[model samples]
Structure formats: C-alpha cells, structure tokens
Target: MNRLQLAKRLAAMSVVLPAAASFIWEELLWLHALALLWLAGAAICWIGIERKHHSGQMRRTIHTLQAASNRTLNHHRHDWMNDLQVLYGYIRMQKPDKMVECVEKIKDRMAEESRIAKLGEPALIHYIQSFRTLTNAVQLRVEIAEGVHLTELPVDSSGISESLIEIMNAYRFAAAPALGEPAVLTMKLSMDDHALYAAFYYQGELTSEQRFASKINQQLEGAPLRPVEAGQPYGNMLLRAEWRA
Candidate 1:
C-alpha cells in the first residue's frame, strides 16, 4: 500500500472507532455486537496500513539499489568502449614501442575488470570477492568479519550479485580520475541466525549526484532499506536481508 491507501485505511478506522466505542460502552446488546464487528474491521485496516508501510520501504530500498547498479553498468560499458577505441587506434598507428606500451596497459586494465565482471552466484561469495577486488585496485583495505553467509538469505541471489557489481563499477568509475595513487576497497560479510549482511567501504568522497540519485531511487521505490551512512574518510554501502534459518 502507498501513502494514499494507508491514509484511506486510517480514515476508515477513525470513523468506525468512535461509533464502536460508544455503542460498546452503552451496553446495547445488539448495537454492541455490531460495534464489535466494526472494531474488528478497524483492526484489519490498521494491520493493512502497517503492512503497506513496511512493503513501501522495502520497495524503495530495492529500487534505489537497482538504479545505482544500472548506472554503474552503463558507465562501465561506456568506458570500456572508449578504452577499446583507444587501444584500436594505437594498434593502427603501427608504432611498435607505443603499441607495446598501450597493449600492456590495456591488458592489465581489462584483466582487473574481467575479474569483477566474471563474478556470479553464489551471490554472497561473489559480492565479497568483487568488493575486495575493486577496493584493492584503488588501494583501499577490506576486512570480512566472521559469520557472513549467503546460504539462507531471503533475497534473490542473482539480483544481489548484479546490484553489488553495479555499485562497485560505479564507485570505480567515479573514483578513477581522482585516484592519485592506488586506493583500497574493503568488504566484510557476516550472517547469524536472524539475518545476512554485507558491508563495503571505499576511500574518497562520493559525489553529490551519486548520493542524490540514490535518494531519489529509494523514495521512488518506497523502501526503508537505504544505504547506511559512512564515517569520515570512507564511503560505505550496506546490503542486508532477513534469514530463514
């Protein structure tokens, strides 16, 4: 349910509440019985409103993550194409020394990208590895805490993997130019009886546009699950889901 639907349910409850309460207090047997029915209806309405709110929050969070992931993927595609063109031009120039240098640079870059791009399910492991690879390329450090498991989480494994890849790609592209030296990207994964969680930390300030896009995407989806706040000198991304075990 959306805000409008929630409001309507609340309004219906408000109207029925007083009528039912008054009839029940008056000790009018038949009227009291009818009031009891109204009260039950009001309770149902309240439950609906609450469920809607929870659902809305979840939806918002999921959408935000998805949009961020798509943007990252698109950015990678653009950069990869541009890089290929440059490599192509270098090859066509027929300058042996420059071609060799260009080939080496392109080869290393492609290799790193491939490592992250190749990640697939099991999503928990893939995300942990991908985050580690991305942050390491930037010279950031990552630590995986104990208890992070992917085995029984209540989320789509493929979707989680895709989202993680997209976010990492976005961070890499955004920070590439600013990287004066190699930086580190760190990740930690843990799980318990009740939940599964993954956390990523990268050095550098995330851009305003990235932050804004994240927020907009979250609101549009209506979910409470938003990215967690990071401390100074680091940016963080947190993904979590309830566990069935």
Candidate 2:
C-alpha cells in the first residue's frame, strides 16, 4: 500500500487504542495491557516499514552504481584512448577549430562528472545515478546548477528520498514508447535562498498523468521536499522537491 493509506490505517489504530482501554474491567485489565502492547507493535511496524524503505533505497543506490560502472567500462573500453587519439589527429591535420570544439565538449562532460562528486549529499548523488540503471527506454539526464554544493541533509531526508523515488518510478512506468522512440527524462538540482531544490521533467507516455502526479505529491506532504510548484509543463510533468536551507 502507499504511504498515505498506511498512515490512515495507523491513525485509525491510534484512535481505537485509547477507547480500547476503557472497555476493559478489572478482570480483563490484562487485556488492556495487551491492547496497549498491540498498539505499540503497530507503531513499531510502521516505523519498520519506513526503515525498510530507506534500506531498500540504499541497496538500490549501490547496485545502480555498480551496474553503471560496469556499463561504462564495457561501452567505453577504448573511448578514452580513442578521444585523445582523435584530438591528436585533428592537431596533426591542422584542424584547430575541430580540436577546440572536441576539447570543450570533453571538458564540459568532465565538469559534470566532477559536480556529482562535489554534491556531498550521498543519498542525492546516488539517487541521481540510480536513474542510469532504473530503466532502459528512459534516458535520465541530470543537470546540477553551477555552484551547487550540498552538505548532508537529514538522515531520513524527511521523505525527500522517498518522494523522489515514487515520482521517478511513476515516470519509469510511464516511459513506455509507443512509436519506438526513447524518452528523455530530465532532473535539475540546485540551491537558492536557504532551500535546496530539485525539479523533474519527462517527455513520455503516462497511463494516467493525474494519478501519477497525485502519488508524487502525496509523498511530499511535509517537512523536507515541500512543493513549490507541481504540474505538467506543456506535455511533460514536473515535481519540484525542496528542503529548508
């Protein structure tokens, strides 16, 4: 079940807990204690579910990183040497313009890679990378605004991680291409005015866009990951996840 449904059930149990004690008389007093214990168990169960989710994210993050590295090595076994050799050839051929363009692109890519490490927020960095392996058709694109350097957020992130995961999963499911065209999913992370910001956008098919958006917004109800603006941009969807600075 979704977190909201779980929360509603837990709230119901909480309401019933106090009333349960009044119904027990002296002879049945032990039953009241049992009921209290049962309520405590339910609370613990809820907490456990949250912890389990966090653990799952961490595991997925590690797996995704491993898979990404493997894919990179397999795909680019000769890429480094090839690029440099090509650049060297350009120089020998008196192609200064081409050489400058190639070097600029390479530097830009390296800068982006460096930004990921400088993010400093392990969970966010890993989450961004996890998209690499999350789906095949959806090409995940992450843009870190220049000067975006983050420190460790809350241990639990107050649901930022969970909400972003939910949104991403929805987009993943919605990314099935009808015309064999691939989907381009973009996410931007940055900081402004004492708040951290994340915005997601995707161009793809969604079985139910309304349902997808609602599910995402629900997870971002409180604390970290507050929504500044959440809606569809043109044909794409966006959820701006944020936390206090």
Candidate 3:
C-alpha cells in the first residue's frame, strides 16, 4: 500500500488499541501500559516513514539539478571551442574585415552566455562544483523570459530552483541528438498563484525512426514518456501545477 494508507492503518490501530485496553482489561494495568507503548511506537514509525519519503524526494531533486548543470557547462565549452576555431580560420585567411566580424560575433555570444550563466550562478555552481570527474557531451541553451524574476515566486526559492533544474535536465536528456549536431534546449519559467510553470523547448526534426520506436499501439496509460509529434522535431515539454478542492 501507499504511504498514506499505511499511515492511516497505523492511526486506526493506535486509537483502537487504547480503547480496547480500557474496556476489556480494566484490572490489568500492565496490559494497558503495553498497549499505550505499542501505540507510541507506531506513531514514531509513521513519522520516520514520512521523513524518509521527503528525504528521498530531495535527493532525487539534487541529482537532477547536478545533471542539468553538467550539461550546460559542457555545451558552453563546445560552443566556445567552435567560436575559437572560427576566429582562428578568419585569422589565417588574413581577411581583416571577416576577422573583425568573427571577433564581434564571438564577443556577442560570450556576453549572452555570461548573462545566462549569472542567472543561476552561485547556487547552480555550488551544486555541480564537485562534478569535475564526469565527461559531458551535450549542448544546452537556457532562455529566461524577458522581465521574469524567479525570486518573486511564493514557493521556497530552493525548491523552485531545483525544480527548474530538473525540468532542464529532463529536456536535455530527451532532446539530445543520437547523431549529428546536438539540439538546442530552452528553459522558460513563469508563475501563477504561488505555483511556478516551466516549459522546455527543443528544436530538431523527428525522423521516421523515432516514429517507429514510439510503439503507439502498446502505450500504457499515464506513461511518463509520451510521444509527441509537433510537425517534426520542434516540440516542447511542459510542467505545471493544479489545485484541488
């Protein structure tokens, strides 16, 4: 059974045991004490179980954030190398005009990258600082909506940040190319009613091979990975929240 069901069962036992002890064994004080002790143990166990559940969720959040950060860094390194190569080629050609244009383009790209890198700077940096051992081979692009401020969200900043990271990582993995140049991944976040909405857009063209791998006829209900066709490779992944009455 689920955690909530288990908690409810323990609660019912706790109430029933105390009442039964009082009515069926009035003269047995030791029995009454033992029943109370059992009830107390059950309560403790229920609390521990809840704690563990939350802890596991937090751990998963951290892992997702780490993966996204690594992907972003790798993408940045690849782009930087590509820019340098272009600059080198222009220099060798001895075309002063073209060389100047290449330098200007590289500067503009660096400025944009620096701005994005600053948005999630310290927090994202600290999370992935220890991940110097892994090799990353993907490209990513993070796009923050103009005039959007993540700090204005009503939820805890850390949770919102981690959720963004998770969404980005999911997009990175789903959009990574199996061949040819890596795809571009964009992360956008907005807010409504104390809830944050995130959207990840990946640009690419879906091939016949992807359509065949979908197993459309055999899909289970509520599958985590849903096959979406958006006029070929340009599709988006969205995450949102809803309130219940």
Highest TM-score model number: 2
- lDDT value for candidate 3? 0.56
Backbone clash pairs in model 2 (N, Cα, C under 3 Å; residues 3+ apart or in different chains), count: 0
Any runs in candidate 3 off by more than 4 Å, and if so which? 1-19, 114-245
Q: Across residues 1-245, which tens digit of lDDT does each residue of candidate 3 receive?
A: 97666785776667786768667988988888887787777778777777877888899999987787787678668867988898889888888898899889888776555544444535644433322222233345555544334443344445445555544444444444457765555656554553455565666543443542243212312423223333333356555532212
TM-score of each: 0.44, 0.59, 0.46
Model 2 lDDT, full chain set? 0.67
Error of 1 at 227 (Å): 25
Whichever of 2 and 3 has more lDDT, that candidate is 2
Compare candidates 1 and 2 on TM-score and give the better one: 2
Q: How many residue pairs clash in each candidate at the backbone level? A: 22, 0, 2
lDDT of 1 by residue, 124-180 (tens): 344443343345445433443433323334655555555554555656655544446
RMSD of each: 11.8, 9.9, 9.7
Model 1 has an lDDT value of 0.56
Looking at model 2, the pairs that clash are: none
Q: For candidate 2, lDDT tens digit of each residue in 41-134?
A: 7777777776777888899999977887777555444656777898999999999999999899788867877887776756666666556555
Alpha carbon lDDT of residue 3, candidate 3? Answer: 66
User: lDDT per prediction?
Assistant: 0.56, 0.67, 0.56
* Candidate 1: stretches off by over 4 Å: 1-26, 51-55, 117-245
